[model samples]
Target chain A: MSAPESILKAENLVKKYREFTLDHVSLNIPKGYIIGLIGPNGAGKSTTIKILMNIVKPNSGDVKIFGLDYKKHEKEIKNRIGYVGEVQYFYENKSVTWTGKFVSQYYKKWDENRFTALLNDFQISRTKKVRELSKGMRVKLAMAIALSHDAELIILDEPTSGLDPVVRREVLDILMDVTRDENKSVIISSHITEDITRIADYITFMINGKIHLTIEKDDLLSNWKKIHFKKGALNQEISQTLSNVKEGMFGSSGITDNYLKIKDKLSAAIEKEDIKVENVGLDDILISFVKGE
Target chain B: MIGIMKKNITFFIQYIGFLYPLMVLYWFLRKDSFDLPAIMISGFFFYLLISGSVNILESYEFKNNVYHFFKTLPLNAGDIVRAKFYNVLIAVFFLFTANSVIYSIIIPDKNMQVFSYIFILCCMLLTLNIIAVLYIGFFSIGFNKMGKLLWITLILWLVLTILSVEMYLIKLDANLLYAFISRINRMVWVIVTFAGFASYYGLMRIAIRQLEQNYDNV
Candidate 1:
C-alpha cells in the first residue's frame, strides 16, 4: 500500500523499575492498520502501551499520538482512543448498565446507539452485575465500551489471552472490522501469535524490555525464511550469516531475513550440503529470535 | 472527576454503606446512659474508626487493579485525585452533620457545647484526608516494599492524628475553648472554620501532585 498517515510515534521511550526496564523503545503506527505487538512475558509490551496512554510516566522519551504530544494533549488524545486491558476492572456489584452510564460521560463523541448495538451483538446483559459476567464476556463488554465511542485508535493489551478459540476469533474479527475505516488504527499486543497473524498488518517484536524488530507483516513474512542442512555440512562462515542457527546431531537449522540473497549465495552449498529451505511464520520467527537471545 | 466520584459512591453504597454505617449507629445508640463527656469521646473514636476502616476497604478495591481501568477513561491523575478528595469530603460532611444532630438530641442539656464536638469532627476529617494524601503520595516510591510496612505506618499515623486532634480540641486552654465554649468569639470560630477549609484545599493540592507523579502505581 502507499504511504499511510502516522497515527502514533514513540521515540526512545524508557521506564525503569526495580524488577524490569523498558530500554530505548520506538515504533511508528500508521493509520488504518493493525500493529501486532508480540513478545514473551515480561517483554514490556504492556509498559509501552501504558506509556502511550500516559498512564505511566516514562523516565524519558517522547510519545506522539495523532501528531500531538501525548503529555501536552493527554485528555484530547485519550478522548479519541479506546483502550482495553487483559483483565478488566469495575465495581463487581455494579451492573453493566451502570458502568456504561459512568463511562459514556467521559467521552465527547460517545455513540449510545453503537454501544447498545455492540452489547446486543456481544450478547451481554446490561442489567447483569460485572461479577456475574464470565471472563470472555467481561472482555467483550470492555470491547463494546471501547468501540461505542468514536475513537480513532484502539489499544488493547492481551485481549485474547486465556480466552477460548471461538471467543478469540470473534474478538479478532471485530478488531479486523474496526480497521476498515481509513481514519482508524489499532495496536493489539498478544503472545498468541495466531490471533495477531490473522489480523495484524504490521508486526513489532519486543523481548526483554527491548524492541527486537518493527516491520510490516507482509514484508517480514515475505523476507524471513527458515533453512535446514544435513549434519556436518555447515561451517562457521555460512552459519554466521544466518540468525538463530543451531547445530544438531542429524542436521543444522536457522532463519534469515535476507532470504533471497542468502539463497542465491548458498545455492552451491545448498546443493552440496543437501539443505532444505522453507517460508517461516510468526511463531517460528518469535521462537528463533527469543531462543537466539 | 465526576465519573470517579460516581464510581466510588456506587461502590460504597452498593457494597458497604448499606450495612456498615447502620452498625456503627447501632453501637452508638445502645449506650446505657448519655454522659456528655463520654459521648463526645466515644463519638470521635467511632467516627475515626468508620473513616479509617472505609479507607482500608477502598484500598482493597484498588488492589483489584482498577487504576488501569481509570486510565482508559478520559481522566488524568489530577482528576482522579480531585474526585476521591471530593467524595471523602462529602462523606465527612455528611457524617459531621449527622453526628452533630444526633449528639445535640442525645445531650439536650443547654450547657453542653455542640460546636466543640463539630470542631473536633472537622479536625478528625481533615487529619484523615491529609493522611490519605500522604499515603497515596508515598505509595509509589514504596512499590517494592512490603504492604505490611505501609499498613503499620498508616495505623501509626492514624493514632498520632487522633491524639493530636484530641489534644487540640479538648486540652488547649480547656476552660476557654471547651468549658466556656460560649466565650470564644464569633471571629475566632470563623477563623478556625476557614483554617479548616484552607488546610483541606492545601492537602488536596498535595494529594493531586502525589497522584500525578504516581498514577501508574495505583
Candidate 2:
C-alpha cells in the first residue's frame, strides 16, 4: 500500500489477554478524515484504540498522532486529542460544573461555551451529580467533555454502543457538525456499521483480533456490488477466482462475490442464463468479512 | 509539580471533612460530656494520621467502578500515586485543623500543647500516605486486598505506637515523644526514602504499563 497521509497510525501493534491476542495490527487514519474502526465483540477494537490513546501500551508498536510518537509526545498528543469511550468514569460525587472546571484545567483549549451549549442541547443539569444520571446521560456528558476541548482529532471507542436511537442520532448530528471544520478528524468505533457508513471517510473491518480489511467508505459503497445467480450457475472455480465473496443459497438462489472479479465471472454466467446482480450495503460487506468469505 | 501537589492536597482534605465526622459518631457515649465533640474529633484526627493514608488508595476503587478508566486517562502511574498521597494529606490535615480549632475553643487556656502533638501526628501520617500510594498502585491485588492496605497500615502504626508508649510509661520523660520521632530520624529517613520512593514510583509505572499492554477488561 502507498504511504497514506495519515494523522493517526498504529504500526504492528501487539497485545495479549488471557484467551485472545491482538495480533500485529497496522492501521492508518488519514489527515482530515473520519474513520470507523468497526468490529464485533472480542475483535480487539477497543484494545487497539486504547493503545493509540496511550491508555494501554503495546508490547512493541508505534502509535503516532500528528506525526509524533505517542510515548515521546504524550503530553502534547493528549492535550490535543479527545477520547470518548463507551463507558467513562466520572467522579460520582462531583457535579458536572466541578468536573468541567477540573477538565478545563488540564486542557489549554477547553471551550466553556461549547461545553455549556452541548450540555444545554442535551438538557443536562450541571448541578446533578454524575451518579444520579442515567447511562445515556452519562454518555452524553462524556461526549460533551470530549467535544468541548476543541480537539483536532477525537477518538471515540464504541461511542454509540448502548445509547437509544434518538441519543445516537444526536451524537451523529454533532459529529456531522464537527466535520465542517475541515481540519478536524474523528476515529470512531461501533458495531453499528450504518453510523460508520454515514459519517466515515475510511473504514476498517476487524475480526478475531485482526483487521480483515481497511477500505475507503466511499470506495466500499460504490465499488462493492453483490452478484446474485442461480444455485447451479456458479461453481467452486468462480468463487476461488474471486478475492471477496458472500457464498450462500437463499430461496433456491445463490449470492456471491462483491469485488469486480465477480462481475467478470457472472457476466460469463449470465451469457448462459438470466441472473440478477444487486447492490450491497456496508452490513453485507461486514457479514462477508466476519464469515471469511 | 506544585499544581499536582495542590490537587492532591485538596482531595485529602475533603476526604476527612466527611469521613472523620462519621467515625466520631460511631462511638457516641450514652451521656454527653462538657467537651464530647472536642475529644472525639481530636482522637479521630490522630487516628487519621496513620489510618487515613491506608484508605487513600481504596478511595480510587470506591470512587469508580472501573479503574481502567483512570488507566486510559492522560495520567501516568506517578500522577495517580502522587494524587492519592496528596489527596490523603490534604484531607487529614484539614481534619486535624478542625479538631484543633474546636478543641482550643472548647478548652481555652488549656496547656496540653495539642498543636505540637498534631504536627508530630501529621508527619507520621505523611509517611503512611507515601507508602500507601506506592504499594497499592504497584500491585494488582484484588479490591478486597486493596481495601486491607489501610487496615494493615493502621495495625502496623498501632503496634509501633503501643511499643513507644510502653517505653515512655516505664521511663516517663516528656522528651520521649521527641525521642520516638527522632529515632525515626526524618532527615536520614528522607535521604533513604529517595531510593524507596524512586523504586516505588518506578514499580508502579512499570505495573501500570504492563496493565496497559495487556487489554484485560476490568
Candidate models: Cα lDDT each:
0.77, 0.67
Q: Write the per-residue lDDT of candidate 2 for residues B1-218, one digit (tens) a residue.
A: 24445655565556555666665454243223423233333453466553554456355654484356555445555555556555544554565566555445444333333433444355434554445553454345544555666566556656666665465557756454535545565565666546555554555555555444432433
Q: Write the per-residue lDDT of candidate 1 for residues A18-113, one digit (tens) a residue.
A: 999999999899888889999999999999998988888999999999998855677889899999887888767779998899888889999989
All candidates: TM-score: 0.84, 0.78
Q: Which tens-of-lDDT digit does each residue in B1-218 have in candidate 1?
A: 78778766665555446655674576467644554445455544545544554555556656666666777888877787678767666666665666566666665555454554655565555555554554455445533243454455556655765675577567455444445766557777778777877777787777677767878776
lDDT of 1 at A5: 86
For model 2, the superposed segments whose C-alpha errors exceed 4 Å read A1-4, A235-239, A242-265, A271-273, B1-8, B15-50, B53-57, B60-74, B88-126, B129-143, B163-218
Q: How well does model 1 score by local distance difference test?
A: 0.77
